[model samples]
Target: MMYISELMTGAPTNERCPLERRMYETLDKLKIPYERVDNDPAASMEECAEVDKVLGTEIRKNVFLCNQKKTTFFLLVMPANKSFDTAAFSKKLGVSHMSFAPPEKMLKHLGTTPGSASVAGLLVDEDDYVQVIVDKEVAESEWFGCNPGINTSHLKFKTQDLLQKFLPKIHHRARIVDL
Candidate 1:
């Protein structure tokens, strides 16, 4: 059985990786209150399910994508349960040929690896090279749940804090899409 502990706000007591540490510092600096849980590495929905129970919110899918050119990169957060139609996403965004980004590029731009990507990665994008996209539905939800720049730790916080405070501080903006 999955081991999901009680929900608690702020960073965990145990030591964390550099990436996760930076994420907590960033959140604290911004004064964006959050609740977090250290679950199994979020590689599968089964693990995500256990996290959802602890967080009291559904964990959204954080997809790392790039255009056909591979020059334009994006991090898209959508409903975890919904299927992502790349074609539909392309059409809605007026972009073309969206495909999953290479893992190396994801690490380079987002400071996160596959299955571990999160909006907090934006803090490391000093170049502001990657665009952030959010599904309208997820953006509208009262609470936002995502990894705090690392897969093992998951966070749930006010959607407003993410949209209004976090994004602006990082000089990143979120383009809300229907898909």
Candidate 2:
């Protein structure tokens, strides 16, 4: 797929999707600079790799998870290639088990679909119910990339800014883990 700029008549700033718009608004409010790249709505990990190439950064896998009772929710960010060890994660979080959160909960809380879960959606999470977890390997990067609350658009920002400024503004905190 071609760059959004080449395929579209106007700039990405004029794109649709309330989630993406809200994320950009927050970035503007904080005076944080970011570069956004739009791609096909990738449906699988391989397709997401194409988006990663276009964005020139690795896209972290954003997983929406919940404990058995569903009282607690988590948004785990890790390297796309990393395998999620439920037992290890449960042990780390002190939970019995962590299963994938349903689509309804994901939409209600993160304002995103299964393939589009991203930290950027935290902009819409007024309750701040979801815990954000980042793999230490992914966190070590100087820059990090994630969806701009839409599957077709990805945003890249300095890792320090993302963890320090962007996440705090959205009332989200990151827990670095080896998983």
- Give the range where candidate 2 is weakest over 10 consecutive residues by summed lDDT: 2-11
Model 1 is weakest, by summed lDDT over 10 consecutive residues, at 38-47
Candidate 2 colliding pairs: none
TM-scores, all models, native as reference: 0.95, 0.91
lDDT of 1 by residue, 25-92 (tens): 88889998998887767787668978998899988888999999999999999888989888988888
lDDT of each: 0.87, 0.81
| RMSD score of candidate 1 (Å) | 1.1
Off by over 4 Å in 2: 1-11
Residue 159 alpha-carbon offset, candidate 1, angstroms? 0.3
- Name model 1 segments beyond 4 Å from true: none
What RMSD, rounded to one decimal, does every model reach? 1.1, 2.5
